[model samples]
Target: MMMFSWRRRRATRRMARGGGGGSMTELTIPSHFLCPISLDLMKDPVTMSTGITYDRANIETWIEGGNFSCPFTNQPLHTIDSIPNHNIRKMIQAWCVENRAHGIERIPTPRVPASPVQVREILDKIAAAAGREDCEECKSMVEKIKILVQESERNKKCIIANGTGNVLSSAFEAFSKPERFEKRVEILEEILSTMAMIFPLQEEAIKHLKSEASMQALVWFVRGEDKSRRRSSILVLKEIISSYPEKVSELGEIQGVLEGVMKLIKEPICSSSKKASLFITYHAIASSSNQEGFTKAFLQMGLVSLLLETLIDAERSVCERALGVFDGICETKQGREEAYAHALTMPVIVKKILRVSDLATELSVSIVWKLVKHESREDEDEEDGGVKVEALQVGAFQKLLLLLQVGCSEWTKEKATELLKLLNNLHRERLECIDSLDFKDLKRTF
Candidate 1:
């Protein structure tokens, strides 16, 4: 009798637990139900199991009214399909029994609250310590703060360092800022002295002096009326040019400043040592190819005649550089006519070019190359009424061709190639000059 009552209690419990497949076999039923669609939980619950389990009249009405679905499948359950005897309900019940008879376990939800009060209190403590300044923690923090600020400032200043800290740029800017001339001059003198001292030690120091700012200062100083500063500036400028041949523009200005420096070189008022220094300065100014000032300076100082005289006694290096400057002067149309006139009247100039060794030969060839390029430009302009080619003298080309034929050095060949290319473009008439000679062969031979 007790066993029968227990079975009845189990059945009652199964009926009380709504919408899930009940365990008829177990006294303790499973906790979860299966959805009709997924055969899992009743995700969207419905009532289409058994007539005794759900409201059969209402479910039948809902299914007929198009509202009822299978609890496991969530599929529309028609009255014909879900009226307990429907074959589809039997299949869903079997699926729910197999898949989810073990039931769905309830999971507890976790809760987390904000900690604003604790965070604010910690921040306030830190702020109070910082404000006290006497706090031991604050002292270390302040040191870190100082370092960060200094680093930021350094980063800001580093941007201008390349331009403002540059010796030449500062010197040039000083020229326009006359109010700062005294300070600039002092810096210039320091830089010049450093340049001179470091030149023999490192070639790069000479390059720094050749920058536009340094060149501008040297040009201004050369033309300035102050004889003492001119003398000093020229001395330093010469030292720079002597070490670095690339700064040839200074030679142009040297011609204008020549007389003053020459006076210093010749005067008994200066010691022999000082005179020699001045002469070296004069030599530096005279040797540059790019500077027109050097030509004017040369003429002003009567250096053309002096250069001719020195051809006999001049050191090989000096002779080579001086001739290079002369060649540079002669390569342009104006320079060519001037040099040709000088060379024609003064056989010494021609002799100097003809008798010069390999170094001098290289310089002479470069000069010829310039002349060739200049002539070619003139030829082009003549076609456009820009200039008259016939107006140009013819002797230069004849001399250049003769030099190319006889010259065998690699430098000569390179210069010849450059000149040939220019001539080929402008004067096809001169192509025969390079037709027989292989530039590669000459390069190999040299």
Candidate 2:
């Protein structure tokens, strides 16, 4: 047998130190008994669909490395994981024992990889345990799957190969239904942790995760007190929401979905969590059904104050996302009212004009235009007419003027022209009214 160079050196040292009784001898390994990929003695040989047999670990590494063809013949493979070659394994083992004097160690039988059937059986038991009183059985079963999932990539593939990903999704769906959530919160938390560990979920899993029940459950976990669970939940939630493009009004069904998701943006567990939170908010309002209704929900949750705080302190990407959502909020009359209600909305938004990214600038300009244009859009004027007044007070005129001078998108420049015209009209009106303020009986008017 051809041993590794390090192994040979170790044996030589052992013999020199009078520790080994026999000197090592070199032996030529047989060609057929070796793995073609590694050229090493076959240990746990498995045959691929292409009819090529290789050591189990080597072949698995090949397939997992994104190869879909045989290593030696270059033929495409129909099946992913290879089947165990029992006969070759037995012969390899017998040959190892017969060549004991040649320093060959007999390969033990390989443990069977966890199969989809096994995962299905455990899932059935878990579903049955949901009705029973004691959850210890459920916890143990989930814990077992958790361990198997962590064992290897092959195990993860085997476990969720079937539609059992949906089973786990439904298990997480318990959080949405309070009656079902009574005794299963702990179990659901465990399930969240397990699913988080095995991510990049298949299509079947994502289908249910986008369902109303799972979305609600995900929102709860994102806002939940368990810090670890929140991290896991957001990681999974971001994938589900962003991976699927079609969003619907089912978002409106959740009680505090907006509030729960905002918690992530308000106080993120990590950078990714913050981005995911922003992604959820941006995506939630993406549905036309969610716009008028859920924008009101966000406003009720004090989204204006939260967004201003984020713009002041967040990084470029976060600023872009927060501003994106804020722009969406500004599309509605109530959205404009809520923003105008906030003390620093105009001032802070003006600050963002030239400081952040161009997208941020565009979003901020859009919001300014909406707030100022509400008079024209609704044909109604506010009691104070502060949209134009506040715009001037916050140096918004100069910023918009600077944005125009420095140049921007045609859309932004056009909005800036309108904003400058609005601000200038207000400036001229304020100047024109200055002389009347000195008169004793002057009536103040905008």
Candidate 3:
């Protein structure tokens, strides 16, 4: 009496009509058309050497998961490759066409992925064309690669894995030289545009490009008339410095690299370029062998002014980086003096405390500590006087207390506590000096 078989059943479907009404359609599917692994209609079905057919996606997933046995048969696989099961795919396509009324949309034919051989061949052709002074052919092949990499993540990875990164690095090494930059501007632009998309570059690919000469070439591109190339060059420079932090000193040694990088910080083209410029500025100070000289150079380039402007308005990440770089600069005596001299410096610094991020707050406190540590703390007029007085007048005292009360990183708390104590001491000294003064003995005219 209770014999219900679930194996064979006619499913009912309710589809939404164009005007939001409901329509019923029943589609009977052939089970052979379903992938055994997914148990769904197979699109781009392919047959394994095991004689089992599956959707190519399912086969790929199974192979990638380290499984060698057929899912249904548990038989060991002799080959990892699968051939396209065109007949099954055609049948599935036909089934979808027959059920078009049930919202069954046709699956477009799959594109053939870019093979590794094709990428290598194209690069080879480009190199040959360039050697022959065939500019048009060379540019065409580079454009093809740009298109290939844009097709899919798999294609991009394949291109990089096949040594596309080193090829680009080599191109930069050859074209980035000032002697070649003019005649080669078009190809340089094309290559730079292509290289921008390939990020997280391998060190071996870029290790040769880290020299002072290469950096100068990069600066040329940064200072190039083509504004777009300038941004692209900055992005590449950022990727390089980030990868080889130890070599940041090499960049500092370059005659004009600092100003070029600072220009980007001053006039940001985009968020990524600005962010990259900030990072380069940070490492230039942080990783330099001669921190004193490097930081001094940064200060003299009006870095303090740029950083103040950034802290005044840059977003959270940019603000944090600028603060950190400022902190580094303030480590040197010249840097501290420059920051202390600016009218808006201490006030803007005070404004950033606890508003941006923990790291930012920490950097702000550290900078304030450096600026105040050696200031002539002797008594002075608050109207136009001592560093401590200006800090207090700018509401630094109240912000310090709030930072301590709200809590912060241990390092930040330590700096904040010390600065707070110093400001409090200044207040105390002023009060005691007034009390000890002989002004009380004089007559009040008012």
Top TM-score hit: 3
To one decimal, what is the Cα RMSD in angstroms of model 1 from the true structure? Answer: 31.4
Instruction: Please write out the lDDT profile of model 3 over residues 1-446, one tens digit for every residue.
Output: 11112211222111222432334233556888878987777777888888999887788788889999998789988998778877777777877788686566777676666788999998887767756656677778889999999977657877988887777666656555676556877886787778888887788667746755567777777875667888888888887887888777877777777877888888888888888888888887876487887787888789888888888878998898888888888777787788877888888987777667778878888888888777754524545568887788766777777667777778888888888888887654332121213122333223
Worst 10 residues of 3 by lDDT: 1-10
In model 3, state the lDDT of residue 277.
88
lDDT of 2 at 261: 75
Could you estimate the TM-score for every candidate?
A: 0.33, 0.59, 0.74
RMSD of 3: 10.0
- Per-residue lDDT of candidate 2, residues 346-396 (tens digit): 878877887777899899999899888784533235555566877776677
Q: What does the lDDT read for residue 253 in candidate 3? A: 77
Question: What lDDT, from 0 to 1, does candidate 1 have?
Answer: 0.44
Q: Stretches of candidate 3 above 4 Å error?
A: 1-23, 26-106, 125-138, 211-213, 246-256, 287-301, 378-385, 393-409, 428-446
Instruction: Evaluate all candidate structures by whole-model CA lDDT and list the values in order.
Output: 0.44, 0.76, 0.76
Q: Which scores better on TM-score, 2 or 3?
A: 3
TM-score of 3: 0.74
